[model samples]
Target chain A: MFFVKNIRIGFRRHPLFENLSFAELKPGTMATIIGPNGAGKSTLLRTIAGLHPMLSAAGSANKSGKAHPEQPPIITLGEIAIENLSLQQRVKHIGFVPQVLPQASSLSPYEVIFSSIKSVQPDLNREEADQRIEPVFRKLEMDSLAFEPMHTLSGGQRQIVSVAQILVRRPQLLLLDEPTSALDLRWQLKVFEALQDQVKSTGAVCLMVMHDLNLALRVSDYLIALSAGHLLAEGAPVEVITPAIIRQIYGVIGRIETCSQGRPWVIADETV
Target chain B: MLNPPAKQIAGTSTLTNRHQQVVARRVLCVTSLVVAMLFIFLLDLATGASNISFSQVLSGLLNSSELTTPEAVIIWELRLPYSVTALLVGLALGLAGAEMQTALNNPLASPFTLGLSSAATLGASLALAFNWNDIALTTHLIVPLFAFAFAAGATALILFLARVFDARTGTIILFGISLTFGFNAMVALVQYLSDADTVQQIVFWGMGSLARTSWEKIAIIFMVLVICVPASIIQVWRQTMLRCGEEHAKAAGVDVDRLRRTLMLRVSLLSAIAICFVGEIGFIGLVGPHIGRLLVGEDHRFYLPASALSGAVLMLLASLASKTLVAGAILPVGMVTALVGVPLFVLLIFTYARRQP
Candidate 1:
């Protein structure tokens, strides 16, 4: 299990969070970060994923009431301050699927997947990279798009392909920032299902920032709600995704009904 | 999820394997092109100037009987060095351009764009205005060396600033262009100061030519080219990673500072060696890699070498065309390269850019 401590983070002069505290996220457990727009939910996820560097805990007040180092072993996904690590080393354990799909020139999807492992062993006298990447493409259902240039891919297809690249690396910490935001409803479920399977097979901890409350409630084992860059609540989804917490974090009037699966079903009250 | 898509497909239909096959085929084709280009190079050498027959040229080259005296002298003494020099310069410029494009993550990036050529021009102009060497030595040796040193110095300076300030690729590129124009203005100033005789010599050298080539100059090109080529090959992976950006490259385990410094040094060195002796032979260094990319795609492993071949071939063809343009009069190699390179490059940029968006 990877642990992050005394995590204070921000960019420029403005601090996003002052001494934030979270438990060691482990395999078989998924953390759903929920917050209103501009609430630093993505910032927290990026920090834990090691994309952004940690700020000093001494400078900011913390609800957790603790202080720790400025550096941690977190691998961030999108818009993280990852100036310390190298690409090859980062790919080994930290697979980042940035929010914006990279507009790579002339690189085919197969070549894109192959590049993730080029550092492990360059295709020196052996073309083992292609053999290895085939299964990954098949698993992500991107075999049809494999020959197409990455730039030509549709939004959902590109998202899947990005996730596929990370999955091929089999990173220990999979940090995804709204990976399913742009995906269609079908692809949204499909992408999360793939993530669930990957977590089961590889036992990697997935820290995701998801916008859909119902989806988050279903997929997440634990919930960390933030309001204005401050942690509002942390607990199991049934305890945390409550009407009071939703009103506080999202300012929405919503009913917390139990779904058939015994998870909280957040049905917003339009009359609010 | 989605039934995982039919487990697996047959061998022939899979794109992963097909991509590998395509990469392999492109490599083979590039290798063949290099071989064919070399054959043409040898043929050009044997037939030029004196119009020696293929048989006579072959016999002379093989050290056989019935080989005429003039044929051997032309092949060995004059045409041979000139051909090899053109080839080596082409190789240097082509590979350097490929590396620059990848390093800066801009397709327009080349030694020329980075102002190396202009700086070299300024250096050569300075040397000419002052008559740095008393003897009226061939422009082949003196002109290039001066250009090389100044170009490398300019490159080193830009890299240093980039490192210290942590500037983006765009910033660095703009700085390079500004420096080029600045140097060009200085060259103009030096031209104004020099006498008519000195100005004529400087102008001719700046025009770029293969007319004054000798073995000694060819040896320098050979050594520098040999060193630059393999170094570029070894760094192709790093170069490709750099194309992803510095942060990405750093995260990939590359020491960003070292990679940047090394690439800057190599590009400057190769560029200096390429045009220093040749004066300012324009587009081989700029458009060579671009044409190679269109033919071989963007995998640096193939693109780099293919560019080297294309550069050499284009240079040799341009030089030959310049030679045969008018029986008694010849054109500057730069004039021919600019004539061919500008229109072709403009077409490519528009076509490629349209496909991107």
Candidate 2:
């Protein structure tokens, strides 16, 4: 199980989160972070990814890189502190899909898919890596786009390739930011389905920041809500995504309805 | 959740076959470039002023017994060294160019553009101006040591500016231009202060000649290449990772700053090796990797070697042009390359732009 404790993150010389503590993020499940703009959603994801410099106990940031375990900004992924792990060590367990796909990469999708594997698993032969990625490409139905250059692919196709980049690695902790933002409905469903299968089958912890509340509700196992960098709510979808909380955090009058699939989805009616 | 049954993952049979074919094609492309480079090397050796017959050149190579012959002396003392030096320097600059561009995250980054070689030239000019053999250091090592120190200093300055200003690729490139101008001024100032022979020697050094290299210098270049080429190829995975994006590479367990710093040092050393012996050869570092990319996309596996080979090819061809452009009279190889490379550089820019989605 991976757990984050007492994370206080913010921008340069300004505070966003002050001594923010949360419970453990268990394996074999998915959690979505939902908040409005400037709500520290992306910042939080970046902090967890060890990109941001964490605020100290005095509610200030002196250094802006990885956080130490003795401090408040530690993420415990298994036995080791996530911040202390080397990149080579980190990639073995953590696969991160950034919100923005890297631009101007002229590599073919086939090269993109295998690039990380070459670095992360140096022992895996070319044929072995192909065997590992074959099933993922087949499942994603991106087999036809495999040889095409990355710049030639559509945004949605690039997003799928990004997801495939992570999935082929099969990390124990998968962190994504708005992975489906560029995708259409059918591809979104397929992407989420693939993620769901990957999480359940491997007992990995999948965390993502999402704007689509309905899709978030249908797919995620746990929920974490924030507004203006403060924790608004966190629990099962039924308890946390109530209309009252939606009005407080999002400034919208929302309704929670039980769909035919028995999933709790949010439908925003009007501004409060 | 909705989808078809897993017909795609049915068996691993089809994926490997296709993957092997793709890998083979890339290998074939790189292999062909190497062949082309050797062909150019041979063509370069044959077409020079001595009018050594093709049969004599062939016999000189195939028959080791003819080592003392006039043909062997021409090949050994003059043509072979020049051609080998051209090939080696081209390969070094090409590799350095590819690594620098990726590390700096700037398409325009190269030894010449970034003033790296200029910095070295500035240092070499100072050494030449002072006639600094009186220093306690070994006589032969002093010039290169001085050049390397200045080049490293320039790199340090650029990296420091980048960190301080939170500069991205554009800002760093601007700093590179400033360094280039500053170093060129320094070199020019030193030339003005020197006596006539010193000035002439410095000016000739600045023209970038493979013809001046001795076997000793050739061996030094060879040693640097043998050490550097494999050293870089070992980091192909890192280079590929960095190409995708810095943050993305960081997330995958790469220390981006550390990687950049290490590459800066390596590129500094490689460019120092190039300019210390030869002088400020421009444009190859900018255009070489672009040619490599045009031939073999961005796969560092093939891209790096392809770039080095193309670098060698361009140098050989430029050497040929320098020999032929004014008949028996020698034109500066640097001038010839600049004339050839500027147009090729423009073509690559358009090609890169057109390929963008």
- Top-scoring candidate (TM-score): 2
Worst 10 residues of 2 chain A by lDDT: A59-68
- Local distance difference test scores for all models: 0.72, 0.80
* Model 2 spans > 4 angstroms off: A53-56, A59-74, A78-83, A257-265, A269-272, B1-13, B62-70, B124-149, B163-167, B188-204, B341-357
- TM-scores of all models? 0.85, 0.88
Write one digit per residue (lDDT tens) for candidate 2, span B184-244. Answer: 8999999889999888867776778776577887888888888887778778887887877
Instruction: Return the clash pairs for model 2, or none.
Output: A53-A64, A87-B253
Model 1: CA > 4 A from native = A11-15, A36-88, A120-128, A227-230, A247-272, B1-12, B64-70, B137-142, B241-261, B340-357
Count residue pairs with overlapping backbones in model 1. 22
lDDT of 1 by residue, B133-215 (tens): 64556354466667777888788889888888988778989989999999999988998988998889878878888766778
- Candidate 2 chain B least-lDDT 10 residues: B1-10
Instruction: Point to the candidate with the largest lDDT.
Output: 2
Return the TM-score for candidate 2, rounded to 2 decimals: 0.88
Candidate 2 residue B122 Cα shift, in angstroms, is 2.9
